[model samples]
Target chain A: METKIRQLSSNLDPRYFQIVVLSALLLYGVAILDFGIRWQNAIAIMLTAQFVQLVGTRAVQLPRFDPLSPLITSLSLTLLLRTDDVRLAILAACIAIGSKFVLRVRNKHIFNPANFALVSMMLLSDHAWVSSGQWGSAAIGAFALACLGFIVLTRAKRAETTLAFLGCYAALVFGRALWLGDPLGIPLHQLQNGALLIFAFFMISDPRTTPNTAAGRILFAALVTAVAGTIQFIYFQPNGPILALILCAPLVPVIDSLLKGRNYRWEQPKGVL
Target chain B: MRILATIAAAALTVAISATAQAFCGFYVAKADTSLFNKASQVVLVRDKDRTVITMANDFEGEVEDFAVVIPVPTKIEREQINVGDRAIVQHLDAYTSPRLVEYHDADPCMDYRHFEMSMDSAAPQAAVLEEARKVARSRGVTIEASYTVGEYDILILSANESSGLVSWLQDNDYKLPKGAERVVDSYLKQDMRFFVAKVNLKEQSKLGYQYLRPLQVAYESNKFMLPIRLGTLNADGKQELYVYALTRTGRVETTNYRTVKLPSNVNVPEFVEGEFADFYRAMFDKQVEAENERAVFLEYAWDMAWCDPCAADPLSAQELRELGVFWTGGRGGSKIAPMPAQDVFVTRLHVRYDGEHFPEDLMFQETGDRQNYQGRYVIQHPWKGEPSCDISQYQAQVRERQEQEAQQLANMTGWDIDDIRKKIPFPEGDAPVQEPWWKRIWG
Candidate 1:
């Protein structure tokens, strides 16, 4: 049964699985959890992201337009980016798709598309914010389970990044609590955040934007954790992981150059290292 | 269309009772901070990096026994600390409290144009100086500044270590709670200064004030948070904290913990109007339980210019400034002005927490969401006047509404449904006709 399931799964692109999982989470958030996400904004983001992806493909003269990448990005933005203005939502979609085509280093994107758009929208206007704490503990528990299933379905090809980032983040949070003489519940509550889970499993674990080597990815995770801990603990700011990711994006190419490994392609379905 | 007619009829009948009602509903009762024992109220007025914090001292004991040790982000100087008027804080509380409002259902028999009407409805510290500094310095503690503001003697202390600070406070007869040493050390490690205030009985007696006024501090820092860890050190099982944030942009919410908006705009049984305080406490306890006791609840978030029901006309510009809203122009505007103030948004957050559930300080961020919200429960009085036409359907609908309200009350407050049903008068007669179970199942 396992062999047959793997055989069936190997034929499909992992992006399809990610898309399904993200859509399911988005549905749960909207319908059951009352995440206060506007349907019009979600629709606008989906359409705008796909349209921008099409335009970028035509401009770059690619063989064909693949809607999966933009669809995943749109679902991510719909799940994370919050704004009262529909125009801002459209702008987020445009920036997310447009960055993939424009910002390149060594034929690879510098930053994760959704991370770039979320951080940019936050800096651009006060209207947009990420409701990191909107997901209660029960929702976080369910989402963590879904993320674990996602790693299984994808065959753990790029699971190293998520694991390394989560491990380092938990260490830092717990370490801080220990030093402060606080109870274990403090760090546990911090780790149970849905936004943090999404960042680890979706944003930071994006193989396309991460380093091409395992050693490089681990080093990258450490750096992001250091910066995130500073922002959260020292400066007492919200959206630490997102802000840290954008800040650390420029260093990925440097890591790629130093470590020297084969680049990842979603269709390859091979080991990351 | 039929539902609309029934609602109109309910409203018309409500007019016969001759009690005032408004768009939000007629003001009945409120669940203010006083509802809970050991409830602490803090007002934060913030814009950009500037923050003015007024800590209300609800310390219920001898003035000499009242002492507060708060962890502040920046060092506070003598000029930065002031004694605030207690009345302003009370006014702010009344303005942002969760309110219960009632509406009258109109007569189903009479045809009247639907209309709207509205009506307006409605701590101490002491300490000593100089020689105390000598004792503090011996304990590796630096007394940043000291001031006698009104009836309170305030001190700003920065310590090299938590043990030294705790010991220094203890030596000075400041009665530090157990497990506070570690918390102080943590704050010191994080580069936070301590604001300590105690009542000066000599000065307090000279001032002839019966109660201790709130202590206000103005500073510039990026950390927008309330230090609740030390408060949790007390033996109290749980502490209630109400934080009223006055900001320029929009609603303020917690970053680390989920900020859930209290259930609002809900229709409830009319009996709730009399026991609003009990109803609110029960509903809040249930909400806290529902969120696993780790959530901060938003009770009210609205523009300070006006209110739909005008709980107590918006605070005047003078009152706003007294609470440290520095950007509201200059001087007092006309007291008779219809609109009292603007450009200030107030957000009321209530948190019932303890050390076990909340380990870290309460951190906040001001969002651009200007959407207005309030903890408003509605009680629509059923029309009791005689009807000129056949009104069995109206009565049936009213009965259904009453049952739904009872269920809603039960669900929200975790009250027994039977007890709720007992409390509700429930429109008389026109019981919902029950279909035969066998025929229905067969069909």
Candidate 2:
């Protein structure tokens, strides 16, 4: 019995456990809130997309951790779709997820999944993410709280990135609101109604696209947040995150090199060296 | 001379139409008899036919010195003219020496007339008629009557008279064609009304009485607080009322209320169905005899539920929680089913509008002993002497009571009742307040 128990526990991979737990939380959270197999089907599409990526690449190398892709894509899908039509939702989900894998360069996804998917959906159909559930103040508040908790529990894995994002976003929004002579109350209300919380805590902290050094990550995050906020304010498009990320993503290597203060070097085989 | 003037005027009119494509210019003439002298003031006119020339006194010439000059050898063309073409001409003095000038074609007056006429005559009429027909078709009404007067073609369709046909017409891309006028004429030529009654008796002693058919009740106790009803009421019991209530989010509720009075004779109409005729005759005689008794009230209710709160606050995070109101869930550790409270209320009143008060002292009793008491009742007339009760007075009383209740609720809730009231207004008021900040943000 003791041996059997040990074998069973040992068989459970830690990474698999992480995936299962996170997926379950996401699925059940939506289900408890009246979303059911519809959302699950969306997740299934995401998984299938991941498998497609694995197959298409034909290389066993795993991609770097991306914080915002899943959250953004899930939130966007939830907001835009009215019916639980599995096929349509899955189709959207696949496009949203697959875009991240296929449209990447230098080991980092170029665009924010949530931003790209939302903007693409808007341009294609009349679907609008602005009117999605995640845009609800209370729901956004809850998501922010959850993200904060996750960040804390994860030992502030991307604390610098988060800080930079929120700081820059606040500055941009405040400056614009003041310049427009809008009552301060209205912009604050608008801030609470958008995906600001999600972008700050999740999208900006994406490890692959963000810089490695603490200061670099902070600067990168701040720059992206500011640019995104400005674009959203001026153009009134929904792809602010993707635009900001794409603009800043290329800088990750430069920022890394600057922080390291050394030319990148590759290791050679011992005998050859 | 009059005839000559008329002929000149007619020729001028035609020339105006034809020369409408001439280049606009201002004529300048010298003030003195010197031919070489340059004119000071100028006249500005369109190059097109019938150019509206504005003369400026700044010209140095007296009226006579400014002999109306025209290019003496001007060439006019009748070729199919395109938009932008110029006229080439030569002018000569009495000395017969020619000078050349160029005049570009200007927009034609007939083009403007054509556009205006199209807008006024065909475009608007077609658009308005098409839209009206579309709306009528949507409402399942057949266009059975039509009349044309001048530029207007009025169409009458089979429709529920009291429904918002005019507003619907205006809202749904419907507009009066330009030049077509609408008139209000008394066109409806029918009076269809009916009344049904029932009664109960206790061992030959008269007990109670009730009026049937024209029943007034709440239809949709949510969203829009409006009262509705079936058709008019007469003594005949063959009339039926169809009631429909819809939410802003597209949820619909439908109910059919029907009543029938029986025939006094054994013989039935040849056109009537046998089952219906027999049922009507038996029901009528039985109801008459039972008029010396009491009355009964029956109510039936059903609901159609939609999972989406699209009609409510679309941007609300509570959309997720809204499903809890319809599905089974746990609340405070106890299992519960979804039960959304009716937020909009609709009442369909089928009572008499003929200025008569119903008897208040009447009691209710069943018509038959069956589980479903399908019968009628009759009672003593309440307003025996008073021929009519003023409808306006009753309306005023109801309005006063509603205002009082609203005021009371406002006081209790400590909410801005006035603000809430602004969001929804009575028919007499202007449009409803737009969705608020939170609603717009979330939605």
Candidate 3:
């Protein structure tokens, strides 16, 4: 028994293995529920992409089992697709997954993967993103997002950034509704239909993309939230998340570099060997 | 042989030069003196490429592009001219840019003459035919044996046949060529295909007032101006009026009316006797009264009703119930109802009038219950003290019921609810209906 345990542990660390398994399950589960028969092609492409990223780059360094990528891709495919539009959904998922790596600056992705994919599809192709799944179904996705949030929060991912993003988005939507005398309920409902919750908890709260200092992260998230909200209200376009991320992503590196540069000196811990 | 060839080449050169001078450039001539003045400028320029004309002006800046320029006639210019004014120029141009064109005096042909004739003598049909034939013969027109409209004798005449008539009538001098027969034929065919049947000739007579008046008067009185003139005699001396109405289907409904006057006016020449004068006067008076009554009703109802004058029919108690009105019987042997009211009230009631009084149509009432007279309640006039206790309280109640019925109809469709609400008569002030969230999705 001891030998078996050792052998299992040596092959792949429990945490890393858990992450890979959970990610795979999440991707397949979302594809089946949201895409049904269409998920066959999507799963194939997603696995191929994941394998390539893991083997080719050797940069699979998630510390905790975070399901942000799978959740986002699933939510995007589910919310912004019709049953027959499998090819487009797969294309969108690929763009979203690939964007995290391709459209990165320095150490972090420049835009939210799902948001980047959605905007690129709209600009380049004739495909549209439509809502699916019942409003009640959001509870499940929200719970999963909360679990992911716990992992990210425990790993020093800033909570204030997520809060700021949510706060700014809510305020802008409410303010515009009041100004235009439109029904306020519609915009509020829209927040739950897209990959908004996942982005708020996991993508924006990414440690590398977020500021190290609490106040800096708060400012970054607030700016991103404000930009996204403004794009949605003013242009009434669906590129809000991408726009928000693009606008705020650069600030993270600048902020991190500033904080780290200022506090470079390290003191030895008393209990360390 | 070389000398002969050179002579031939010189002759060809001279012929080409003369042709170019004759056809290439725009011509400038006074409208009264111009040979082409009789033809429509639009027709003259039709299908002719690369042809442009400009009006002679003292102002020498960049002039805007225009389609055509019509010169106000010398008479109008003299009347409207200031001391330094050369001529009054009427600019007709393409919508994009103003391209000023040559100006000449107004063509006398554009001024239309109004004439009216009524045949009410014994054998009125025959009288109309006889009058038409006489007019055709006096004008030297050939009456085609096969060309007979129902109760109307039509004569086909070439410009030459009617040259004497043209000489007599100043406006008729601008005669179209024989080719214009096709234009007239095409217009008649299209017009006939799209014509709306006349509902009531009497009501139409009243409607004709605004049309027969002076162009400026008619333009001011009506919200929309029809492209065609009304109460005008054609070259055939037939009095016809055209009414254009926009239908619910978004197409124009044109109704034509032949002038029908009292028997005394049949023999008189329409232009001299002013046959359409009474028709105009009557129409204007009725229109004014109708407008005033509408304004008063609108003030009380707080909104305008979509009343179709042609659809206003009297109803009995049973018929009223079918129309969705709740009813009760009353003293003085009258029927009444408590009607559902809305924010707006529109009624298309058909009523028959006897002198100054309008009696209800008993057939619309429900039978069996003598006391209530088919579920209707009779009541005193709401505005009995008002000077025009003229309109019945029952009519008002009917209007309210009609509004409620319309509202219920709109609720079923889930679309145009607001518009339907606006059109109904509500006793209470404007209040929006609060639909439950679940019902919004399901219902």
Candidate 4:
């Protein structure tokens, strides 16, 4: 019985776990937190993403079609993106999946699909925005726990990006507090935000889009954090990390070329790929 | 795309307490904001980067003792400062305040029709000059600009350090609150300038105004936020703030903290009309607690063109222009299209905050959502005259509704359920009556 359980855990891909967790969070948000996500829009995003992914697979002639990636993207987009028009939601789904095929370098997508779609939608239409404070601080504790569990479940593979990003971000916030002579409570309150957590844990920490080497990932994390801090404090804008990730995505391939390392694949075991 | 932002009907809570007859029902009393002590009101008109802010205070003390220090995002010159009319702010309060409405039930034996009636309810000294200047200069404080605008003397100050600013304020007889040094230092590091105002008694007498009017300032910056940190430095237990945000787009909400809509459109007992002020206070207290006292409550968000059951008439273009809405064509400026041309969206946000839960200042962002939301509560009056035919079913349903209203009131206000039920005048006939439990067993 123990060996059978071990076999299931060992052979199962981490994306399945990600899909379950993201879906669960989505359920919690829509059901309990009043995220204000419309049901029709959620359906359109999911279906449009899947349809685009299928067409992209056929056009590229990949070995096998995988629906999990698009499902994950759809869930992330629904969780982050807000718009009154269903057509815009559908358009966002198409752009998200389409970017994975068109914007590739060294056989890896440069930007996280959801991040690309969100930025594109914001630039393309004025009706779309990200409600960063919708998740309120009351749910931060439970959310942090879920994210920590996710890190443990993934065996900490490429977890350096999440750690480094959060560490650098916290240092910058606290440093600002000290410089301003403000109370510690101010920065503490700022840090306890759900949107920032979502960005740190799920969006920026995508192993496929991050650098291949551990050292390269840390460097990339610092770069993104610096840009994000500038945008938020200097420019006085919201969703700094989200906008920063898209701006910094193109540098991943450059970093990978400079510091040579093995590429990441979901199916392959460590040291084999 | 012309997006019509209409809120869910279920969430329709309108708060118009002023005595105005509009909509389908007769207007009644409203929840007066005077129930809150230490309350401050601010009107912000924002478009892109240019912002005009009007700060109003109800200082009920000797006019000579009134003074205020506000942190501004940019340097203000004389043209950027203006004294606003107090009546306009009062009118805005009446226009956007959460309202109570009454719906009289039609005769069940006769033709049935719904009826609703809407009703609405509605600083400091200064210091010396040349000797103060040397001290201020030594303390790294720069009096950037000084102007006398309509019964008040205003000084714009920039400081190199917080200590200098604090000492300068103290030397000038402005009592600095404890722990204000830290807050002042924080603002200085951010490169924010201070707008200091004190009543000019001679100018006040010349202007023939008894009470102090609000202070207005206009500046251009990317920061769409209010500095409440310095206000929190005082030992006041809690402060109530009403922010009336006028924007060109849809609604404006706090980006840093959660902005939750206040409960609206719920039916309550008939007695709520008398003590709506109390009911509003209790309901607001309950909501603040529910959100853990860390949220900004959105009381009203509507287009300025018109209102269905308006608490008061929408502000005219002339009035809106006075409140710093620069988009509208001003007096004699080719009076163009009348209604849609006044593209001003007003959002009313109320918060009871202190230094603890609300550690940081409020940060806001304008969204594309144009949904009109209001904090409106409803009450229904039962038929009083003699019925022409049998109305047994109607009375039973009315009793059930009364019970529901009782439970809802108790749930929202944390009031005792039995006490609420005792107050409710439940229907007399055809209502279910409780029987002794012993009868069921013994009989």
Scored by DockQ, the top model is 4
Residue B65 in candidate 4, Cα distance off native in Å: 0.8
lDDT of 1 by residue, A140-170 (tens): 5646654654564355477777878989999
**Looking at model 1 chain A, which ten-residue stretch has the lowest summed lDDT?**
A145-154
Give the per-residue lDDT digits (tens) of candidate 3, residues A1-273: 999974554454223432443354346445533222245645644654454344424455655444434443544444433323456666766676767666676766766665566666655544343222121123345466556554444333245677777777777766655554334443454454325665576457655556666667777877887788766544433446555786677677787776664422111111211
**Candidate 1 Cα misplacement greater than 4 A, ranges:** A138-156, A261-273, B1-37, B107-137, B334-339, B429-443
**Shift in Å, residue A80, candidate 1:** 0.8
Tens digits of per-residue lDDT, candidate 3, B327-347, equal: 222122222432322221111
Candidate 4 A-chain TM-score: 0.92
The models' CA-based lDDT, in order, is: 0.75, 0.31, 0.31, 0.74
Tens-place lDDT digits, model 2, residues A181-267:
333543454455334554554456555566656677777877787778766544433446556776776677777777875322211
TM-score of each: 0.88, 0.33, 0.31, 0.88
In angstroms, what RMSD does candidate 3 have relative to the true structure? 31.3
Tens digits of lDDT, candidate 1, B1-443: 00000000001111111121111000011112111123567899999889999876544345555555666777777778788877667667777767666677883342221222222210233332332443355678767667677887777787888777766766664544457677777777777788666677888898788776777889998898887776566434766677889998888988888898889999999888777767888898899998889889998899999876645567788778878899997356643553478899999898877778887788899987889998877788888888999886777678778888988999999999878877777556322223244643554
Candidate 4 off by > 4 Å? A1-6, A139-149, A152-156, A261-273, B1-37, B107-137, B332-341, B429-443
Q: What is the DockQ of candidate 1?
A: 0.64
Model 1, position B338, has a per-residue lDDT of: 35
Q: State what share of the real interface contacts each candidate retains.
A: 0.54, 0.00, 0.00, 0.68
Comparison by lDDT, 2 against 4, better one: 4
